[model samples]
Target: MAVPGWLDDTRTSYDTVAVSYADLLRDALAAEPFQRGILALFAELVRAQGPGVVADVGCGPGRITGYLDGLGLDVLGVDLSPGMIGVARRDHPGLRFEVGSMTRLDLADDSLTGLLAWFSLIHVPDDEVPGVLAEFRRVLRPGGVVLLGFHAGDGSRLKTEGYGGHPMHVHVHRRRPERVAAWLEAAGFTVEAELTHRPAPDVEGGFVFAHR
Candidate 1:
């Protein structure tokens, strides 16, 4: 099957800036109590259900994946960009990292117990999001949990440059929490919680927790 143009662009762009991106955001969550609390909440929820596999899809550089692992979750990281995966592996030598896309995951049916797609969906156009959610639902078990982090807003913008002026060609799609929840519902997941936080003055972060 042929890869979509946008997906290719996303992969290439991330590949180009993987190192710089990793360096810049490695300690990002340490300063954000709210975001850390949200991740902790997600980890706590997963831990309450007993032992299970948790995957950080689009886990750029594996920073968050490592965090979850430190919290005692059997976590693995997956990303569309090989460059990112390489950096992730190098940074967290103890963790597992794989090159994969959320649009078409290589995971088996109902194989995952928990999944996180933090700020990764922003690169996917709105129309393609439903398909991605369907893929998520397909890979998760009946009671599996999903946590999505994205930019909260109502538009898409082309990001032509990234960390340290690295060239990129990707669209950053900001989406509303309600819109994401609607998509999740259509994909057969029950929305459990939604969080909107202003990590920056101009940027609102959106998080939605759901279960299948």
Candidate 2:
């Protein structure tokens, strides 16, 4: 099948800003106490299921990937942007990073014990989310954990610039937690947890912890 236009634009935009993006968010997780707590909790959940590997889907520059690794889950970082993967490998030479997409992840079924898509689904359109969630389910082992983070609310916007004011052409989407939970259920995932956080007056964060 032919690739979608938005995928190309998103890939190009991230490739254009990969280094600056990496630099901007390198130390970001340290300040995010809630994100850290949940990640640590997630690592525990996966470990409790016995030994297995985890994939950080849409891993960006591998910040969360490294954090999860520190928490003791064997980690693999995958992203839609090669530039992002390059920076990931450069910054964390000890870990594995690959160029891949959640729309169609390049992995075998039931291959992962855990999966993370941190704020990466914000770029995907609403119509595409179910397919992406299905892909998530396909790669995860039965009872495996999946973590998803994204902007919370309704509607979408065209992100024209970001990360040190570099030009970007990607759509940023926001969805309510309930809606996402419904999608997860429809995809044969059991929704385990739902969290919403507000970083600013107008910004709401959505996180869903689910199991396949």
Candidate 3:
């Protein structure tokens, strides 16, 4: 089942965990070349397009959002977890951070020039992904870009570490790149790029770039 609880509690757990193991999380990410490359590419795209504003959906702790901001894009960070939003706000006070769900963003239609969903949809139940994509389509302006990352495989159950010694489990419905590409096309995005790489332990994922 989807997480029906308030996003605040989920974020609180992440905040607690981050406070104790910030360095651990930081060091662990250093091993992720695929992730690094994905972010680099997205930054390059934003620079190339010169988008005025961007939204980082499911922006946990503001890492990707901060990267986008560094590229000079007006970036807004949104996530469902309050703890994550709290951490993002505390860590990057200059940027805007909001507690919001991807399925139902609190923004006007065609308000964004770019959108990034790196590793954000991994936990969303498969049936809900299309709706989330529809929401993405709603907020993005024509010629806007979207960068999405997801684990590569068939649908399955998985667990990953959450905040403060807690375990977060969810149904991970992985899809082939072609299938996702088709879905994005159906949702009004044109495929621009797609790449797959395994750069960290237990992470098998790929990224897709699409333009609205």
Candidate 4:
């Protein structure tokens, strides 16, 4: 989906608020049981792949990126928001982070051993998802894995607003796990395992794990 015009200002605003944003999420996730569950699931998924190099798409503040790093896997955190990248770098100087779009990754073809998109693709329109997945497929080795986390159901843009206290209006695009699995398969990724959970009260989504 074409990003809304306000997103640029949003990024700039986030740059200023980056430190606070990271601190808020860090504390919240550390105490939230649901958040911990999600992190545990992510670790298990990465472990299952028997990793080499991993890229965390939309890795805001490098939260998951740091976790992967602790596991001894080479990880690069990529985000479209430079503000987020800046904060990620400051908080986790030992890790690598880059500013880039998921639709167009700069990495070489088949260069990645694994890819993780944790609720990062929700801002992308439904039509554009295939292209992004194609890029994910292109960067990953023939048998590499792609683990995706997305909001459940056919959620519309009207449902979600800005994230936390961020200055920009955030949009949520939800897709069923099976539908996304089909797209991955069409992009040459074999469907593997899928798990679902509700992280925020009644809110629910599933993580689709596939192999390229």
Candidate 5:
């Protein structure tokens, strides 16, 4: 099957800035108490569902994946950018990182106990999000959990540069939490919780916790 143009563009854009991106975001969790707390809750809930793998979809540089692993959940990192995967492997040698797309995951049906798309959905076009959400629902077993983190707003923005002033070619799409929750519901997930926080003055971050 042919890969989507937007996915290709996003992969290439991240590959170009992977090293700088990893360096900049490696310690991101240290300052965000809210995000860390939410992730802890997610890990605990998913682990309670029984032993199964958690795919950290679009897990850039594996920081979040490592954190989840520390919480005792079996986890693997997946990303579209090979460069990002390389950085992830280098940063956390013991964990697994693979290059893959969220819209069409390679895992077997009902194989995952959890999926995390932390700020990774922003690069997916609005029209394609439902399909990606369905893919998340497809891979997860019954009672599996999904935690999505995204920027809160409407419309998309062209990102011409990224970490360390590297050139980038990607569109960051922002959506309201209600809209995201609705999409998850349509994709067969029961919305468990919704949280919003302003990590920075200009950034309105949104989170949706759902179960399959």
Candidate 6:
């Protein structure tokens, strides 16, 4: 399938700022206790089923991927930006990082034990989210889990600049947690838990844990 225009734009934008983005978020997990807790829970759930691979989709710089690795999960990172993948590989030499898209994963059906879409779906257009979620569903083994983190809101915002004022060309789309749950259900996932929290005073974070 040809890459969607928006996906191409997002890939280009991230590639342009991959270095800066990596530097800025390299140590972010250190301060995020809630996110870490969620990740621990996710790791436990995936490990309960048996030994299998986990794909960290849109794993910029591989921080979460590396973290999951430390938790003893066989995890690989994938992103649309080759530059980001390069940084991820460089930063975590032991783990695998590759250039790939969430919209159409290259893996075989029922291959993954778990998938993490950690705040990465924000760049995807609202209309395309279902297809992406379906792709996530397609790649997972039965009883596999997926964890999604995204901004909670009712609309989209065009991010013009980020990471030390570098120009960006992506629209960050926020969705209600209920709406996202509906999408996951449509994609054949059973919603396990939904969390909405304020990581910062101004930012609302949404997390959904679901099973296939």
lDDT of each: 0.91, 0.91, 0.76, 0.77, 0.92, 0.92
Clashing pairs in 4: 1-125
Write candidate 4's Cα lDDT for 1-212 as tens digits.
55555345445555656667687676555665664565566566656667567899989898878876876668999988898998899889999999988878989997888888988877777777888999999999877878898887776664332446545455667788888888888988889867777666868887788888
Considering TM-score, which of the candidate structures 3 and 5 is the better prediction for this target? 5
Model 1 local distance difference test score: 0.91
TM-score of each: 0.97, 0.97, 0.84, 0.84, 0.97, 0.97
Error of 2 at 187 (Å): 0.4
1-212: candidate 1 lDDT, tens digit per residue: 12259989999999999999999999988998998899999999888767889999999999999999988999989999999999999999999999999989989998888999989988887778889999999998888989999999888778999899999999888889998999999999999998899867897999999999
Q: What C-alpha lDDT, on a 0 to 100 scale, does residue 173 get in candidate 2? A: 87
Error of 4 at 27 (Å): 3.5
Give lDDT tens digits, candidate 6, residues 1-212: 12248888898889889999999989999999999999999999999979999999999889999999999999989999999999999999999988999989999999999999999999888778889999999999999999999999888777889898988878888888888999999999999999998987879999999999
The lDDT of model 4 is 0.77
Q: What is the lDDT of candidate 3?
A: 0.76
RMSD of candidates 1 onward, in order: 2.2, 2.1, 3.0, 2.9, 2.2, 2.2
What lDDT tens digits, residue by residue, belong to model 2 across residues 1-212? 12258899989999999999999999998898988988888998999888888999898889989998899889999999999999999999999999998889889999999998889998888788999999999999998999898999998888999999999999888899999999999999999999999877997999999998
Q: Over 4 Å off in model 6, which ranges?
A: 1-4
Stretches of model 5 off by over 4 angstroms after superposition? 1-4
Backbone clashes per model, in order? 0, 0, 2, 1, 0, 0
Q: Which structure is stronger by TM-score: 2 or 3?
A: 2
| lDDT (tens digit, per residue) of candidate 5 on 52-112 | 9999999988999999999998999999999999999999999999999998999999999
What value does the lDDT take at residue 212 in candidate 1?
Answer: 92
| Pairs with steric clashes in candidate 1 | none
